[model samples]
Target: MNILLTGASGFVGRELVRELQQRADISLALALRSPGRSSGPTTFVVGELAVDTDWLAALARQQAVIHAAARAHIMKDEVADPLAEYRRVNVEGTLNLARQAAAAGVKRFIFISSIKVNGEATVNGKAFGADDKPAPEDAYGLSKLEAERGLIQLAAETGMEVVIIRPPLVYGPGVKGNFASMIKLVEKGLPLPLGAIHNQRSLVGIDNLVDLIICCIDHPAAANQVFLAGDGEDLSTTELLRGVGKAMGKPARLIPVPAGLLQLGATLLGKKAMAQRLLGSLQVDISKTCQLLDWKPPYTVEEGLRRCFGRSN
Candidate 1:
């Protein structure tokens, strides 16, 4: 099978490429902005991501496509209209690729979406399910939701299988942003106020996410399905930090602070949304993925952390 994978240089895409190379039956055609940067037994097509970008070279003779590239969510707005920028790449670019793939006779398209499509946080201990109506809370989430809808409609019209996988807080080696910041803080033994946060959150390991994407490539049951991917275990912010500490062979120093006070301080500092992510509950129920595909995460949170931090032999 020839698979066209976009975003070959991204955090997830790099790891996914390593995983894909292990499969002897699959050949890769990487879609990158700079084809000269990648040297492998894979085909590299140079194309920008936008409404008018060409995808014929990437889609030709490919059996499936794993669309992993997108405009990532930003914490601060430097752009005049962030939604339009997000729509330009995530929605319009995605649909353009999907339509071209369908025209090229690609059988399956795997969309890597985010849990934000189900909303930022869970309500009253209820986990977000695949069947839940989308309630995207931000520009990035809304764009992803729009892309999913377009892909499903395209699938219906063209007989191409579309598989949507929504993952929450993916972590692994080379992780950046908030997850990396937290790890750095934990390694430094800095005092954190999140010990008082009692909210639960679901996180997926990159290996597990890559595994699920491979499963969706050829599974008949994955056609036109929306699935949530996670480690099947949820943890509180305090527990997550402690786990990080353990993986780093360090002790966590946690200072008890009320979640309300934390939120108030974040609001004053213009970090209320970031505070909510740390203190809020965002659980995902991945039962449908398991029941339909007979799949389970191959790595636990601890093992994933150990491997990521180089604590495992």
Candidate 2:
């Protein structure tokens, strides 16, 4: 398979290349905003996703294109205006690229979307599925939802196949974002008050996410489908912290703080958003994906966590 992948240097994309390159039959061509790096079997192209002009030839030749580029969430920069920037790249940029891929007769266009599109806070014990209504809270998620809408509309008008995979929180080697921060906290022996928090959240390992993406690329039913994927197990903040502690060879010192008070303090300290993410539930149901594709995750949550734990501190 000749595949065009974006965000090659990003967390998921980097591991994705490593996993996909093992197959002698797969050829990878990476599209980046700047071609400043190279690794494994990937060849780079320097161009931003915001433009409608280039990448046509490359898109025409590749059998599949996995769109993984997007503006990620930031904690302190909540009030900042990133809509224009996100729309330029995540929305308009995605549509432009998809249109080119469709015109080029590409077999499939797989979009890596965030589970944030389904919700801002956790759905408690409830699991989010592919058919749930979109309720994007922040600008980043809203932009992603817009991009998803545009892709569906485009697919309807064209014969191109569209597959959307919404993952809760993906963590693994070279992982940044909240997962990395948690690892840092655990490594430093910080006193965490999450032991009392029993919220269930689902997360995807970089390897597991890549495996699902590969399945979607070749699965016939994945066409014009929206799937929510995870590690197939939901763990609470306390449980996750314990796992991280175990992986780091240290037990997490969880405090018995009230969830309400934690939320209050976070709000007072201008960290309400952060508190919600850590204390709330963000579970996803991968049953549809599993049943439809007849696929099983190659690694369990413990194995995935161990992979990141070994890489961190």
List TM-scores for all candidates, in order. 0.97, 0.94
Per-residue lDDT for 21 in model 2?
78
Highest-scoring model, lDDT? 1
Query: lDDT for every model?
Result: 0.91, 0.84
CA error at residue 247 for candidate 1, angstroms: 0.4
RMSD of 1: 1.2
Whole-model lDDT for model 2 versus the true structure?
Answer: 0.84
Query: 135-162 in candidate 2: lDDT tens per residue?
Result: 9987789989999999999989997889
* Model 2 TM-score (2 dp): 0.94
Please count the clashing residue pairs in each candidate, in the order shown.
0, 1
The residue pairs in collision within model 1 are none
Question: Residue by residue across 43-141, what tens digits does model 1's lDDT show?
Answer: 666577888888887788999999999998888869999999999999999999999999999999999999999999986899999999999999999
List ranges where model 1 is wrong by over 4 Å: none
Give the least accurate 10-residue stretch of model 1, judged by summed lDDT. 37-46
In model 1, state the lDDT of residue 294.
92
